[model samples]
Target: MDFSLFAEEYFDEVLRLLRHLCTIPAPSGEEDERVRFCQEYLAELGIEATLDPAKNLLWTLGAPSQRVTLFMAHTDTVFPRATPLKLADDGTFLRCPGVGDDTANLAVMLACVRCIVEKKLPLHRTLLFAADSCEEGLGNLKGCRQIFADWGDRIDRSISLDCSYRGVYCRSVGSHRYQITAETEGGHSYFAFGNKSAILPLAEITCQIYEIEPPVVGNSKTTYNVGILSGGTSVNTIPQSATMLAEYRSDHRECLAEMETRFAQIFSRAKEACPRLTVERVGDRPCMGEVDPRALDELSHRAAGLIQKYTGICPEFRSGSTDCNIPHSLGIPAIAFGLYDGGGFHTTEEWLRKDSLKPGFCIGLEMILREGEAE
Candidate 1:
C-alpha cells in the first residue's frame, strides 16, 4: 500500500493540524480549545461533528447501520498547560511534548477523514471517528465513557489509535485510583507530639499498601503505588490533615476486586489512629469481564494484520490501560494500535518519526474502509 501520493498532498495539512493542536495546551479536562478546533475543522469539510458534554468530538461516515466501527484518538496530553510546547523537526523526527502520543494520531485521523470525504470513498460499515478527551492521568477515560454511553449498543467494534507502530493492546489493564485523607486536631508540634497526628495515620496506611504482596495470575500482574503525598501547613505545626494519591492495577477482574478489598481494609484500620480518616476512589479503569474468545482474536488479528502489512512488523498483542478500557468493559470488541513510531511518551521530550505519517494514513484508511466484514 503506497501512500506517497496521499502523503504528498496531505502531509503538510496533517502537520499543520498537529502543530496547532500541540500549541493549544490540551491537558485532560482542559481540552476545550482542541475540541472546538477539531469540531470546526471537520464541519468545514461538510462533516457533521458533534461535541458532547464530555468534550468528545464525534462524526460518522458511511451509511447508517447497526454495525459500526469506531476509531478513537484522544485530544489530551499528560503534560500540564504550564508546560511549554516546543518542536524540533530535523527532517526525520518531530520532537515535542506530545507530538507523538495522541497528538500525531489525532492529526492522522483528521487527515484520513478529510481524504475520505474529499474523495467520497465508500465503506462497508459505519465508520465513527472520535477525537476524544480525558484519556491521561486522572481524566479516567471520561471521553470514551461518554462515547460508549451514547453509542455503545450501536458499536460492533472499535479501534483506538494510540501507542506505537508495532503493537496492538488486546487486553485491558484495569486500575483503581484513590485519594486518601486523614484528619485530626492540630496543636503546636511540641505540645501535640503525643496527641493523634494526621500524618502518622496516612503514612501508616501508605506503608501498609506497599507491604501487600502483589498477586500474580498467569500472565496478569497486580501493582500499586502512592504517587503523591502531602499535608502539613508548616514544619512546626502538627498536621491537621494528610492526603495521598494512590492506585492499583491488574489485568484480571479478580485481582482488581482483591486489591479493592485490601484498600478498604487498610483505610478501615487507619481510623484507630486518626478518627476522621476518609478514602475516595478517584478512578476505576476496568479489566475484561467475560468476552468471547473468537471476537477478541478476530479484533486482534485484523489490527495485527494491517500493522504487519504496512510497517512490516509483527505487532505484539499486549495489555494496557487506555481508551480501549471503556469498550472492553462493555463487551465490545476493541483493539488499540499505534499510528506512528515514537518514544518518551508521558514526558516533556517526546518524539515521533516524521516520515511514518504516510504509511500510517494508509493503514488507518484501510482499516476504516473494510472494518466489520471480511478484508
Candidate 2:
C-alpha cells in the first residue's frame, strides 16, 4: 500500500482529535468526560454510540453475529485530573502527560471507525469499537471485565490499543495488588522508647517482601514491588499506624501462586511479631497460560505484515497486562497494540512521534479490515 496516499484523508483529522483528547483529564475512575467526548465524536461521524452501565463508549458495525471482533482503547490515563497537561508540538513530536498511552491510540481508533463506516467497508463478522474506561491503576480493568463477562462467549477476538509503538502483546500477565497496614501503641518517642512502633513491623515486612526471589517458569517471570508507603505522625511521637501498597505480576499461574504464598507468609510472620498487622488483597488480574502459540504467532505475523504495509515499521510480539488480560483469562484470543514510537511512559513528558499518527491509524484500520473479513 502507498502509505502516504492511503492515510492522506484521515491523518490530519486524527492529529486534531489526538490533540483535543489529550487536554481531557481522565484518570482511571474519572473517565466520564472523555467517554462522553468519544460518544459525541462518534455521533458526529454518523455513528450512534451507546454507553454501557460502566460508561464505556461503544458502537457496532455489520449485523449482529455469533462471531465478533472487538477493537477497543481505554479512555483513562494514569495522570490525575489535577495534573497539568502540556500538549506541545514542534512539527515532529507531540508531548503531553498521556499523549502516547491510549490517548493517541484512542484517536487512531476513532478515526479508523469513522473512515470504515464512511467508506462502507465490507465485513463478514460483527466489528465492535469501544472506548473503555478504568484501565489504569486501581481501576482493575473493570470495563473490560464487564465486557467479557457479558459478551465473551460470542466474541472471537479482542484487541486493545495502548502504550505506543508498533507491537503485539501476545501473553497476558496476571497480578495481585494489596494494601497492608500495621498498627501499635502510640506514645511520645521519649516515653515509648521500648514500645513497638507501627512503622517498625511495616518496614520489616517491606524488606522481607522485597527479598523474596521471584519465581521463573520457562520464559515467564514473576516480580513484586512496594509502590507506596506511609505512616508516622510527628517526629516526636511513635505513630500508631502505617500502611504499604504492593503488587506482584507474572505470566504463569503457578508463579503467581507462589508469589502470593510468599506474600502471605511475610504477612503472617509480621503479624506474629507485631500482633497488629493485616494484609488485604485489593486487586487481582488473572494470567492466561494456555494461549495457543501458533494462533498468537499467526495474529502477530498478520499485525506486523499490515503494519509494515501501512507504516513501514516492523512490529514486535511480546506479552503484557492490559484489558486483554481479562479476556485472555477466559480463554478468549486477545492482543494489544501500540500507536507510535514513544518513551517515558507513565511520566509527565510522555510523547509520540508526530509522523507516527498516519501509519498508526492505517495499521489499526488494516487490522480491523483483515480481522473482519470472511474466513
Instruction: Give RMSD to native, each candidate.
Output: 1.8, 1.8
Off by over 4 Å in 2: 1-4
Worst 10 residues of 2 by lDDT: 1-10
Question: What is candidate 2's CA lDDT for residue 18?
Answer: 91
Off by over 4 Å in 1: 1-4, 233-236, 372-375
lDDT, candidates in the order shown: 0.86, 0.84
What's the TM-score of each model vs. the native?
0.95, 0.94
Candidate 2 residue lDDT tens string, 143-168: 99878877788787888888765677
Provide the clashing-pair count of each candidate structure.
Answer: 0, 1
Q: Residue 146 in model 2: shift from native, Å?
A: 1.0
Model 2 TM-score on a 0 to 1 scale: 0.94
Model 1 residue 113 lDDT?
Answer: 88
